[model samples]
Target: MPRKPRTSNISRSDYYDITFYLQHYACFHCRKAFKQSFDNQRTQRLCPQCRQPMTNMGTDFKAPAQKEVAQWRKVQSLAQAGIKFFPQWPDGRPGERPDTLAEIPAFLKQVHPPSEGEQMLERRSQEPQRPQTPREGKLSLQGFAPHQTFRLSGKMLITGDGVQVFHNEGWVNAEVSGHGNNPKQPSHLRTFKLVGNKLYYAETVPLDGTLRLRWPAT
Candidate 1:
């Protein structure tokens, strides 16, 4: 039998730590950080554009330079990853992908385990989740006609620092949310994982802020 690859320790920065790691760190695969580090194993991450996931090749993974790591770094304001994802391509789940390198410590603040100090399970038991509440949010559209049906077709592309949305109708300043291409739900209610150049997420739960999501660009 072959021996499993050695799981290496990931020296963490303050920004990317999560409760999963007592020290707090995200899994290269899930983009969801962990407290416990996996012994040099592979993992996966979801990409917003193609609606496909990427992976991390543990063998070649290494700490990058400050400038290089800057790409994966979390912008304080826009909430996007400064670094890239691992695996380089799409082998689907639990495999090679790009590096989701940077994040703010606040982003993963809610992910800690429950032990009286962290409150992972305790929080879950306390609060049941519901869908997004309709706050008095504003929608500034460039060419979006009210009640129009525009499909991203499971393929939405966003670039640049400022927010720019291109719906089937036209472009505007807005973000996305959902679980990717499921034709069942109404497009508006489908719940997409957002995309932006300086994007960052506050939580994991698809519907509400249970995973308290955000991408504030600094």
Candidate 2:
């Protein structure tokens, strides 16, 4: 008879270690979450806690800590079925459970009391401070500071000579010229208006002839 093939210890050890990682799964019947091995989980769909068939939520998620799990269990106990929350959660589609499982961390942070050190740090971070940069770099406007930046689109005229606009990490010298009696005139920059510290500028290419981009006046 032919000799039977032998299993290598190294391959068996690697397989055991790799398969030991926790996989996140949920049981719709019991409304519970659990961590289990792939082989056992495949064969036994029944939850150890509930002894009911579970819906595989996949292996990409981290299991919540014991404290968080206990706290969430309390919340689940109080939650009413079919009642929408103050802010209704976005649960992609029917049959696919809510992705709100990720929100547990934020919920925990909000409801749980922080240590004295954490409270002190949070308070200190909230205090306001003066602007560190000089006023020369910012654009001055009617309702904004000289250090603020605002976007310019449509016909605008910049009165100040040697006026530099911030672009691509460094300041670039800008020269404005008129559209020469055209019905649709180009945008002008009369004064710098800063809406917020950070702004996004995106250009859209539409099939129609007309081109338009708009920014808030306030």
Candidate 3:
């Protein structure tokens, strides 16, 4: 019972030079979420089970149970829409997340407006222009300018330069080739070759039934 247990009055931050914050990374496909110390230099985090890139759900994310498919799907949709679970809104209020799948569309619309491609297409449609040739039969590359983005289908968003494809997970390097009528269907299809021998066929027309050809907004 000596005086050997004297406590220091130093603050925690002053004692520990480097503070490490925890961040949650979720793999929706695996229905798993784990925490890792935040590393500013680290760019990508891969799931331990699936080896797929994990979504950074931020510090406030609480993972749903593995059996809760609907809940997981909602979370996945939010992640795909580039929404992260933060503790507080930008205005300092507590975050309010949608509870059901049906409410997600309205919530997303309120938080995130139409994407860049949609706005660009809308603006172009308003402008006076001549009717152009339909791209249903040809493979002309004129519409695909550099740095533009187009929604190839519900599951795929491709860059105009044919360099990358953004799916539910994230953007991946891809090669777009063999543009023409799909052999299996009457619609036009664009072949996309992903990094790991994964081939995807996306319709030239987007899910909204619009074929974007105008330049994207900068």
Best-fitting candidate, scored by lDDT: 3
CA shift at 79, candidate 1, in angstroms?
20
**Model 3, range 40-116, lDDT digits (tens) per residue?**
56567889999898887766789999999999999899888877765453664328889877789889988888899
RMSD (Å) of each candidate, 1 decimal: 27.7, 19.6, 22.0
Clashes (candidate 2): 9
Give the runs in model 1 whose Cα sits over 4 Å from its true position.
1-57, 60-66, 69-107, 119-218
Q: Choose the strongest candidate by TM-score.
A: 3
lDDT of 3 at 173: 36
C-alpha TM-score for every candidate:
0.15, 0.21, 0.42
lDDT of 2 by residue, 1-218 (tens): 99989966653223433666544555544556776665642365678877886544434433344456553444343232321122112642222223455654454455456889998998989988755532333222232232222224322333222234444444334333223342223233332333477433322121111212222222
Q: Per TM-score, what order, best first? A: 3, 2, 1
Return the lDDT, model 2, position 96.
22
Distance from true location, Cα of 21 in model 1, Å: 25
